[model samples]
Target chain A: MIELQHVTKVYPSSPRPALDDVSMQIDKGEFVFLIGSSGSGKSTFLRLLLKEDSPTKGVIKVNDKTLNTMSKWQVPKLRRTMGCVFQDFRLLTNKTVAENVAFALEVINKPQRTIKRVVPEVLEMVGLDGKENRLPGELSGGEQQRVAIARAFVNRPLVLLADEPTGNLDPETSQDIMLLLERINRTGTTVVMATHDYHIVDSMRRRVIELNDGILSRDQSRGVYGLGR
Target chain B: MRVNFVLSEVAAGLRRNLTMTVAMILTTGISLGLMGTGLLIANMIGDMREIYYDKIQVSIYLADGITDPQRDAIAAQLDSSPEVKDYLYESKADAYARFTQQFQEQPALIANTPQDALPESFRVELVNPQRYPVIAEQFPNGQNGVDEVRDEGDFLDRLFSLLNGARNATIAVAVVQALAALLLISNTIQLAAFNRRNETNIMRLVGASRWYTQLPFILEAALAGLIGALLAIGGLVLTKILFVDKTLAGPIKAGIIPPVDWSAIAAISPVIAAAGVGLAAVAAYVTLRLYVRL
Candidate 1:
């Protein structure tokens, strides 16, 4: 669950604010999408949600913890409960698919037994079962994305924040990935996906929040991502 | 939390940056080896000084045809001299007897010689042979038929000065090389860190602890240093045993130059081994401190 109250951010060199007093809330077990154009505040909103950058003005809460006021020391602990996927898969090229997923557990100092057990199941669930031994280079773009998904899910984090999860995949592959994300959401983990993909946004008819030039322009339940001039 | 996991990561990291690891090893090895040389030379100088000061006895050859009154005056002067530990006056007859005994192979020559042909001498021992100048100066241009005073310790002083110079030069050279190696290894590790920046980021993102990310790099550098140090230690032993002991030790033992302090060289090997591993770890930690982020 996430809540941003009057959150605003401004970069020193830019006149236009990246997020203009954006206030929104996302509930547990909810599937949501933040849709906008190229310069939309979608990514900025996600960054704030992940606590990667502090907001200039206001409070943002995730899992009942107010991130805006949390000290630097507490940020990593906050992130432990959330899974994040980037536009670029961000896989370590040197690590195999299993290692990439195992990386998540490793950071948490998970036991080898847990890693050996969970890594394969997560890989299998994301359709990368036998390919665990293969490196990222050996996998296709879609499979690489699947590996990323498995890594995100392996920790069984409370929330999943994705910034363009399927931007590089074909539409059909995108649907398959979205279906996987939807299945994960059904398992009671919150999902906040930020994207410029109109079709998937329109097709899902999930709770939608649209941002335009750093302003939250729409909030609708079971909504399509259409709110143009 | 797991030491083995940290070690495995370290092993993998070392494997990843093989060239940098090797460079760190060589840098540490060369620095420590030079340092060991300075230490060994300094110790050897100390040993030489010890032996020379302890064993060098002064010889005072008495003048021929000296009367008992002259001997009495010499004995009076010797008794008051601060340099003398103990001195015994050997008569001409006693000198001839000693010569005959020492040169037993030529007993006939000694049996035919008259006592007057041998000179009366004072066999003098000093309080400290290093204070040889004290007694040697006493009999200079002999006032009481004291022919000459001799102490062999002056030669050791010259040798000590030479070794001291060598030790100082080795220390200076080692310091310069140590700094240069530090800079070079720092750059190498920096480049290696840059190459793995993404991996570091991912680790940070995944909630890996600071040491979790750094332990591997440090261990890799340490392992490389360990290898280099072992090589240096082996080389040092080989130099001492094969070259120093076998060739130089024999010639020098017969007093051509000076005997090698082999125990000192042997003592240096373990320190070099420890230094090798220490330098590698330090380099790793230092480079990481300057360039890496948790």
Candidate 2:
């Protein structure tokens, strides 16, 4: 579960707050879609959730842990419970698919035996079982995204935050990636994805949260992309 | 935390940036070598000072026509002088014998010297060599039985000043070279971090701690520094065997200059190694903090 109470983030160079006194909550095991145009504060919202940038004023709680009061050393621990995927698959080009996926557990000081056993199982879950040795450059866009997803899910984080994960993929590949995310969400991990793709948003009909100029415009359950545009 | 994983990362990093790593190692080696040389020179200077200063004496040469009564009067005065710690009266024959013994290796030089050419003198050792001027004033040159009074301390002072200058210059050059080495290490670390930005970014996304991401870079720099230190120790060992022992054997054997002992090199080896490792690791850590986010 994630909770934001009147969170407002203002960059010093900017004239307005990126997130203006917004409050929201999402329970566990929910698939949420965050839709907005460019510079709609969508990325800012995700960044605040990751604690990459602090909210200028307000509190954020992830799984009942207050992020504002979290010590600097605890940020990494907080991040460990939440998986993150970016628009750019962000895979290590030199590492094989299995290595990239195992990297997550490795950084957390996972045992070698666990890494060895779990990397293949997660790779198989993401449909990357046969391509374990292939480099990211050798994979297609959808497959690379799958690799990224597998890496994020390898540790079975409590929540998954994705930002424009399918920004570079074609519509067909985007649907496949959406299906993969849907599958991941069904495993009781809360999923929050931010995107500008109207087609995918309309097709899925998940809970839609729209942001308009840093304001929370809508929070609709089983909502279409352009329902109240 | 995993030793093999971190080590493999370090090796991969070093191999990935082989040229930079070599540059860092060579620069670190040259600087540390110079520093070790400076330390050795300082040690030698200290030993030489002890040897030369301990033997510092004021010699008062007697006149060629001096009678026994005048010499006896001078000896009586020297024996009662509070400034003199000890004095040895060397006759003309005694002086000639000492000269012959010193020049025994060069038979031609000893054969050319006449017996009476050497002067009878009192070799006066003072409590403090710096008080040579007091003895010189007491035993004036060209007075009574004294032909000339000279202080060996003056020549030793000049020699030590020259040696000190050389030591200071070597240390100065070593410091500058160390600075250059530090800058090269900073640049190399920055380049390494930049090259691996993508991997590090993903690592961060997966909750890798900042130190975890930065460890490989720090270890790479440290490993290079350690190797550089080993090279510097080797250079010092080589210098001692090839140059000091081989080239300066005559002076060292004659006790004109002190020998470069193996123990001296051994003593300063750890210091040089620590400097290499500490400076490179610090430089890499600082570079990461200032320039690279990951």
Candidate 3:
């Protein structure tokens, strides 16, 4: 479902490349953990996958389409097929939980009937059915993360790229988010999550790709974090 | 993408930046008002030119005790001149009667004037009003029966030039104010975008197109512009009713200045509205393109 061949990304005014000649592949329906410390090119990897920024060299193919050759107008269409969740949860603070989930569908121009039917079902799946009208500020951190996950999954995207989904949560709350993500993965949504949380990484034995100094150092099946880095 | 969603977002954004929105509306209103005033002045100048240019005349006053033969000779010269299109010889009694009629509203001034105090003159319309110097050269002042040759067109020229200068000054000030209004609109749009950056970022991630995220800010600017245009039109209407119609009634009634009718205001109303909305929307779009990421 995803392939990167010798991708190199060098930002202007920076001494070194953000990602240097990195190549990797992930099959469909795989829950992969991208383990790296800060400035280790984890976020850069996800950004390239989303086509938010083009690689300086080499090629990236997501779902059989070469991202490097895609036109600018097609970028939004490509992103519509994949959902993204950030470390900050990125919820519209003024909106209620249900409105936040519906926002994703609305952005894609979904019909009102579809948005009405899908929003509630996704909220139910994420365990936020009853708190539809509660704003993000009124919700707990765990609940807010659940809203973000609901928003990501509302459209039933092919792949979910999460950048430190539980970075701001407590340890117990982080486990709940991990379990929710794992549940989403089991339902045939490929998940690529970047994180520095070792406990959640070790608890879930999945395909792990580790980055060190802009290079792919390890790729292991049924892997744990901090074992090869 | 959805119209309702875009509209709701616009409403929310306007509410969030209510003060800035109001400021933008008032600024746009003042700018558009000045522009409308400039346009009205230009139209009035055109009308006044049409009315006055055709009526411009040069009056050649006679000496106090000029003989009939000298008056006849002057008349013969005026009739033979190619520059004179037409001429009216006003006797002293005729001049005094015209003076009384002109100052009828000021009875006291008319009463103070003697019956024969006004001079007998030849009111000559030139083939081209600009050929006044030619007539003055033909009949020199203090020669023949000509006491002094007065070109009314010259005074009208100076008056119209002063009016034109005032019109140009008004338009220049209006241009500067419009520029300030555009800058304020750009700043307001930037602030609105910054305040909602988090929402915009999420929209971008959730597959909203850049245009979809930008629609709300653009719509907010357009809405303010629309309101400002309506206010400016209202201001113009009020000025016409309270100031022009009421305060300047005497001059308009006496035909000193042309009346600004409803049709004239109607002619420029759509232009003002279009300018207000179009300028504000363009400014907002440019600001977003140049400064805001989304």
Every prediction: chain A TM-score: 0.96, 0.98, 0.98
Candidate 3 runs further than 4 Å off:
B90-105
| Cα-based lDDT at residue A131, candidate 3 | 100
Q: What is the lDDT of residue B260 in candidate 2?
A: 98
Which pairs of residues have clashing backbones in candidate 2?
A: none
Instruction: Give one digit per residue, the lDDT tens place, for model 2 in B1-294.
Output: 877878888898899899999999999999999999999999999999888777657888999998899899988988898888888899999999877765666789888999999999988889877788888888788888799998877778899899989999999999999999999999999988888888787777778888888999999999999999999999999999999999887667767789999999999999999999999999999999999986
Give the CA lDDT, 0 to 100, for residue A7 in model 3. Answer: 96
Which whole-number lDDT from 0 to 100 does residue B172 have in model 1? 93
lDDT (Cα atoms) of all candidates against the true structure: 0.79, 0.90, 0.90
Question: Which has the better lDDT: candidate 1, or candidate 3?
Answer: 3
Instruction: Please give the RMSD of candidate 1 to the true structure.
Output: 5.9
Superposed on all Cα atoms, the candidates' RMSDs to the truth, in angstroms, are 5.9, 2.3, 2.5
lDDT of 1 by residue, B1-294 (tens): 777767776676667777776776677667777888787777767766666555446667777656789878878887998777787778888877767665555557767887678777776778766776767676674667777676655555677788899999998987887777677666766766777788777776665666777777777666777887776666666766787777665345544345556667678877887777777679879889877765
List DockQ, one per candidate, in order: 0.46, 0.73, 0.71
Full-model lDDT, candidate 3: 0.90
* Best-to-worst ranking by DockQ: 2, 3, 1
Pairs of colliding residues, candidate 3 = none
| lDDT over C-alpha atoms for residue A16 of model 1 | 93
For candidate 2, give the DockQ. 0.73
Separate clash counts for every candidate? 1, 0, 0
Q: Of the native A-B interface contacts, what share survives in model 3?
A: 0.71
